[model samples]
Target: MSTTRSTRPPRTLVHPGPSPLSQRWRAGRVLPLVAGLVALVTACPLLFVALEATQSGWDSAERLLGRPLIVTLLWHTVSLAAVVGLATLVLGFGAAWLIERTDLPAKRTWTVLAAMPLAVPEFVHGYCWVSLFPTVQGFWGAALVMTSSLYPLVFLPVAAVLRRSDASTEEVARSLGHGRAAVLWRVTLPQARPALAGGALLVTLYLLGEYGAFAMLRYTTFATAIYTQFETAFDTASASLLALVLVALALLVLLLEGRTARRGGRVVREGSTARPGRPLPLGGWTRPALAAMAALVGTALGVPVYALGYWLVRGSSTTLPSASIWALTATTLGYALTAAAVATAAAVPVALYAWRRDTRLARALERTAYLTRALPGIAVALAVVFFAIRYAQPLYQQPPLLVVGYAVLFFPLALTAVRSSLAQVPHGVEDVARSLGTAPLSVLRRVTLPLILPGLGAAFAMVALTASTELTATLLLAPTGTDTLATQFWTYTTGLAWGAAAPYAAVMTALSVPAVLLLTRRTLGGTRIPREATR
Candidate 1:
């Protein structure tokens, strides 16, 4: 009898490849240089702003600080930020819970309506509400207008968290003999706290830098004060001094907010647990609830639309020329498009290097990109203007300057989006391609590019939207002859011709809606869709 041939398991394929140590060492040297460049660009402006503030002579700074009006302005700004922050937390959480958790009718419509105010710039809302009621100014007007415009920032994030939360936790609490109210108080709110807190922090920071609405309403906040000092006083030194104080205030908020954000890390759990519980029926409260909803939407969306539309129709008969509008529109589109492209491109390397090639230097570079967003648009624009005029005078008043300003102001949005999308991609796939002899550059171009296109699109859309709606920086840095829709609206409104200003406001608002819709829709759509489908 012949002995049976021994059978052996298929030999695993193994290849000796370049070691990671060698690759990392190579990247380490080059990455630090890139990181240094990024840091220099991002930090130089902040440093300059601080230097100017300190050097502007404390005598003037102290003189302004001694004035009663300045003290009152300080109080008003702080109070507005505090009150608006609290109001946003309450209104945002309540509205989000009602629309997302309760059996409220027309959840989708409510979502769209709630987020629509973002399309209406804070200034426009202030203008419209002021038009409707002259008393809506000062503290009450600032708070109401800020809340109406910003509550959505809180609502969107909280609603997303609410939709994905495991209702099973609440059900379990109820099964253990807890009441509905108890379950919510003990379980649901704790889970949603992080999103709420983060949203509140954003609202606070925005309020800190707010200018248009507060200024229009005759509210003397730091933002308005800084603008006034620059405009009325004809004193760059005092404005810089005030801007320093503003920056300090902003940094303080950011520092505390960062700690809170870190502490709430556990609340933002990754995987969804189960279908959310059905909304409690508002049987007796339905009429009152519906009426409240109507009022919210009517004031935020309806008034702006009505005022803008009425004025736009009437502007055709006035001195506002169509050619001027069209020209500004093209200028605005060019600035926005260029900014979007540059920001998206810059974010890719930062995100990719951070995600795939994690290293100390890479992470630092990524953080540097984000530093720009924290500085606020006005600071960024002003810093650039200062430097551009002093050093790169030829480039001043050029489109390229505006594009750079946008990239500096908005690269973080693109970086976050791209990095998040890249994180969702599997590393094993990249390994497989590498093992098949694909070059690193080729792999990134072919494999990573296709998967992250949606993120790039989303990022571009966001940057484009912000650039289009941007008022402060655009106001300061736009070419002498150029007028964006935002600037045009401001001009007409300031001239006491609400009828003429309405069209530009309406068009600007209308243009902004598509981007807001894209943001909310894509964001919520991603949450609603199955993860497997996303992959």
Candidate 2:
């Protein structure tokens, strides 16, 4: 007789203590409500988009969407996303392979450098390229800047997966007479398919709503057009229509990403006996491989630094009062820190709700928060403005209002970080704590939060990093007279004062480094090295 083994992962039972109904209710009630509320808050942007678009009649939408410029911009958006998406996957995957799987020189140093581009803001990347080579100001230029800045999104995930994944499958294939190349194509890539699909989705959705990079590169995408319509033309009807188009494009990307992920072959991750793939010796390929890695880092990270240095040296305005710069830096830090705290705190309830209960509603609520992530910064900013003006007039243009916007805009990111952390927690640890006559709140405070400290740290750092660099939203939602480094940088750049912008850019890059380091350490720590492999 054959015994059947279930493929499903074990369900984390939340039913602990008293009656099943009481336990389920105790586990869920407040958590579900809190998570649902968070989900609803995140959906504010989508709500605003829908309502604003409705303000335009079918005729207005027809005229707006029918415009040749609109059509061209849509095509521009799709094409750029495709190019950048493909380029990032190839570069990201190749770089991950070089750093994680190949016997590259100074692997640790290379790993940090590979993830360094993420420290540079997207707009800063564009500014660096455009300021240095003014000729780099079109589709290709935009692609180059975007690919450089965003490739880390793909690289980090792929590298993390590669670092942790078992090499036994590849070894078995190799022993079956398959070459290294075949094993990689068949075994390794399949394992990383989910990560690749997720990364592609992020890159594509970001392009759909991106304004800063394309704007700086002089590339007209739908996101930029929407910004121009809203900010420049002050035409809500037209802007809303364009935003709807962007949302549609984002949905299409989501659908495609889901489909790609679904079509992927099953990933095989065996238990603890599994071992990491050993680094393959490069042999004669070492020099060429080194050259390739150098070129990538040089273009992606080196150019930005060189450009900033050149501007600092040449710009007569580089001496812009240190007091002023410091004040702006302080202001930026304050806002970023506050937003990070708020976003992370808000995420806990949502993440906890999903963790405690695996119901459909809980899952849907968690997913709802992610939808706003696909929106452009401008769209999210506008949504905040729309709601703040209508519902909470006092919050309009207030400091707290901007914090709310940041929380809403980056909620999904925070949720992901927190949830991932919570997922790693030993199953029923919280329940076991509660079973010991501890109250739910105490168990959460003492047991749950401690277990997910790393995740919380990662979430806080990531939110702070992104919030500090955020431009489009800050420009719109900032209270009157508040100045951030991003806004100052944008101001100087727009005025052709690259010299003045250099300091802000430099400082912003510096601020991001610690956060990047923390995230890398906490979120994607190095996998354990086997004794034999190390020898």
- Alpha-carbon lDDT, every model: 0.73, 0.81
- Residue pairs in clash, model 2: none
The TM-score obtained by model 1 is 0.85
Q: In angstroms, what RMSD does candidate 1 have relative to the true structure? A: 6.5
| Model 1, residue 194: C-alpha shift (Å) | 1.9
In the range 512-535, model 2's lDDT, one tens digit per residue, is 999877655532465321110100
Per-model TM-score versus the true fold: 0.85, 0.91
RMSD of model 2, in Å? Answer: 8.8
Name the runs in model 1 displaced over 4 angstroms. 1-24, 28-36, 58-70, 265-274, 313-323, 352-378, 419-438, 526-535
Backbone clash total for model 2 is 0
